[model samples]
Target: MFTGIIEEKGEVVAIERTGGGALLSVRGPLVTSDARHGDSIAVNGVCLTVVTAERDVFTVDVIRESLDRSSLGTLTEGSAVNLERSVRADQRLGGHIVQGHVDGTATLLSREPGESWDDVRFSLPRPLARYVAEKGSIAIDGISLTVTTVDDESFGVSLIPTTLKLTTLGDRQVGDVVNIEVDVIAKYVERLVARQ
Candidate 1:
């Protein structure tokens, strides 16, 4: 599990494509400092296990399913990605509970810049629409953010200066794809309600 709190911004150093999946190498000095084989790390909202950790880089295997479901396939060698290690039992949950299990991918639709922040809108997948609510929480590319607005077709979030300065969202443009994880609690509530 993770808190969706980004520890650092890392760069995709290599992606070696294979028949069934791909081997991805990332340079994340902070996250890799104490990482080890089998440790879970959230990379762009996807919880991937470290196959090897050394120096300032770590490698993880991305199965075909993950590539097809998330924006990870869109990454290039130099693409910047949000990185966070799994939450510890003793630390505060700075963000919402995030499994790093990306539900789907969303396209960035627009961005309205504020004096000190940015209000960004992204296209919402229809099937997941019911799970999103205004003022609710959602994880975009692993960075937990509050939903400021929502409709059947899209949703919006306000990004503060710190977010824009520290994460990949700052470089996102209209048409860019990002991973989305709706509030897990909402999904559970819907499931229980349906059985009534």
Candidate 2:
């Protein structure tokens, strides 16, 4: 589990592909400072296990399922990624509950940059539309953001300067793919209503 609060931005050092999986070597001193083998780290909205922990780099194996479902597969060496350590035992929920279990991907539709902030609109998947609402929480590329507005096919999120400077969303352009994880509570509500 994670809080969607990005601790630091990391860069992909190398990618080693296997038959059905790949091992990603990432450089993040902060997140890897205390990281040990088998620890969980959320990398660009995907929860990956640490297979090896070196000084400032760690390795995680990405399986075929996660690659097919997330934007991580498109990452290459030198690509910047949002990195967050797993939630601690007694920390406040600064952002929403981010399981790092990406449900699907959303494409950037448009970007409205303001003087101090930016409002980004993304194309919403039809099947996941009902799970999103205005003012609800959504995790995009491991960064928690609120839904500023919601339409049948799209939604908007306002990103502050801090977000724009820290995460990859700052450099995102229209048509770029981003991993999205909807609020878990909304999914539970939908499931309960469906059984009634």
Candidate 3:
């Protein structure tokens, strides 16, 4: 599990296609400093196991199913990605509980800049709409953000300068795809209600 707290921004150094999957090597000095084989790391909201670690880079194999569900499949060498290590057992949860299990992808619809921050609106998938509420939490590309507003088709989130600089949102443009993980608690609540 992760707290959706980004540790550092990493760059994809290589992506090799295998018979049934692909191997991704990312250069993240901070996250790789103590990373060992089999450690879990969140890459753009997708949890992947470390297959190999050397120097400032670590490699993970992405299976066909994960590729089909995330934007990671489209990444190429030199692409920048958000990276986060698993939260410690005793550390305070800086962000909400994030499983690093992306539910789906969302598209950047527009961005409105403010004096102190920017409000980014994203196109929400219909199936995930009900789980998102105004002021609720959502993980976008592994960064935890709050929903500023929500409607049937979209939701907006206000981003502070720190967030913009620390994560990939600073480079996002209209029509770009991003990984999204809705509040996991909401899904459990929905399941309980449905069985009633």
Candidate 4:
């Protein structure tokens, strides 16, 4: 599990294609400092296991299913990604409970700049729309953000300067894809309510 708090902005170093998957190599000095072969790392909201860990870089295999579900498939060698290691048992939950399981991908619709912040709107997938609510939490590319507004087809989030400077959302442009993970608790509640 993760808290959706980005630890560092890592660059994609390499991607080697295999028969049914690709081996992803990312340069994340902070996240790889203590990483091991089996440690879990949240890469752009997807939980991937480390296949190999070196000094400042680690490699993980991205199966076809994961590539189809998230935006990681569009990544290239120099693509920048949000990186966060799995939360330790003793660490505080700075963001929220994030399973690193992306529900789907959302497209950037617009970005309205403010004096000190920016309100960005994204096209929410229809299937995931009901899971999102105004003022609710959502993980976008592994960074936890609050939904400022939501309509039937889209949602918006306000990004502070710190977020713009530290995460990939700062550089995202209209039409670009981002991995979206709705609040896990919301899904659980829906499931329980359905059973009643």
Candidate 5:
């Protein structure tokens, strides 16, 4: 599990294609400092296991299923990614509960810049629209943010200067794809109520 709080911004070093999947190598010194072969790292909101860990870089295999579900397939060498290691029991939940399971991808629709912040909007998938709400928490590319507004087809989030400077969202432009993970608790609640 992760808290959606980005530890650092990493760069994609290389991507090697295999028969049915691809091996992803990322340069994230902070996240790989104590990483091991089996440790989990959240890359752009997807929970991927470390296949190999070196000094400042680690590699993970991205299966075809994962490729179809999220934006990982669109990535290339030199792509900026949000990186966060799995949370420890002693660490505080700075953001929110994030399973690193991306529900789907959203396209950047527009961006409204403010004096000190920016309100960015993204096209929300129809199937996942009901799961999002105004003021609710949503993880965009592994960075936890509050939904500033929500409509039938889109949602917006306000980004502070810190977020604008630290995460990939800062450089995201209209039409760029981003991974989206809605609040997990909401899905659980929906499942329970459906059984009643």
Candidate 6:
């Protein structure tokens, strides 16, 4: 599990494409500092297991399912990504609970930059739209954000100066694709209500 708080921004240094999968090597000193083989790390909101950890760079095998589901397939060498270690039980939940399981991809529609923050809009996937609500927690590229506005087609979030400076969202451009993970609680509530 993760708290949607980004620990650092990492860069993809290498991508070796296997037959059907790919091995991704990311340079993140902080995240890879104590990372071990089999440890889970959130890379751009997708949870991937550590296959190799040597020095500040680690490798993770990207399966076809994960590649197709999220924006991982679009990643290439030199891509910047949000990185976070799994939340420790003893640590505070600074952000909302994030599973690192991306539901779908969203397109950056537009952004209205404020004096100190940016009001960014993103196209919401049709199936995932129902799970998003105004003021609810959402993870965009692994960074937790509250939905400031929501509609059937798109949603918006206010990115403060800190968010703009810390995570990859700060450098996002219009028309760029990002991984989206709606609140897990909403999905569970919907499932339980459906069974009733």
TM-score of each: 0.99, 0.98, 0.98, 0.98, 0.99, 0.99
State the lDDT of candidate 2 residue by residue for 2-56, as single tens digits: 9999999999999999888899999999999999999999999999999998999
lDDT of each: 0.96, 0.96, 0.94, 0.95, 0.96, 0.96
Model 6, 1-196: lDDT tens per residue? 9999999999999999998889999999999999999999999999999999999999999999999999999998999999999998999999999999999999999999999999999999899999999999999999999999999999999999999999999999999999999999999999999999
Q: After superposition, how far is residue 19 of candidate 1 from its true place, in Å?
A: 1.3
Each model's backbone clash number: 0, 0, 0, 0, 0, 0
Q: Measured by TM-score, how close is model 5 to the native structure?
A: 0.99
Query: What is the C-alpha lDDT profile of model 1 across 1-196, one tens digit per residue?
Result: 9998899999999999988789999999999999999999999999999999999999999999999999998899999999999999999999999999999999999999999999999999999999999999999999999999999999999999999999999999999999999999999999999999
Write the number of the candidate with greater lDDT, choosing between 1 and 3. 1
Please state the error at residue 95 of candidate 3 in Å. 0.6
Candidate number that wins on TM-score, 3 or 4: 4
Of candidate 1, the 10-residue stretch with the lowest lDDT total is: 67-76
Q: 39-146 in candidate 4: lDDT tens per residue? A: 999999899999999999999999999999999889999999999999999999999999999999999999999999999999998999999999999999999999
Decoy 3 TM-score against native: 0.98
Clashes by residue pair, model 2:
none
Using lDDT as the measure, name the better of candidate 3 and candidate 6: 6
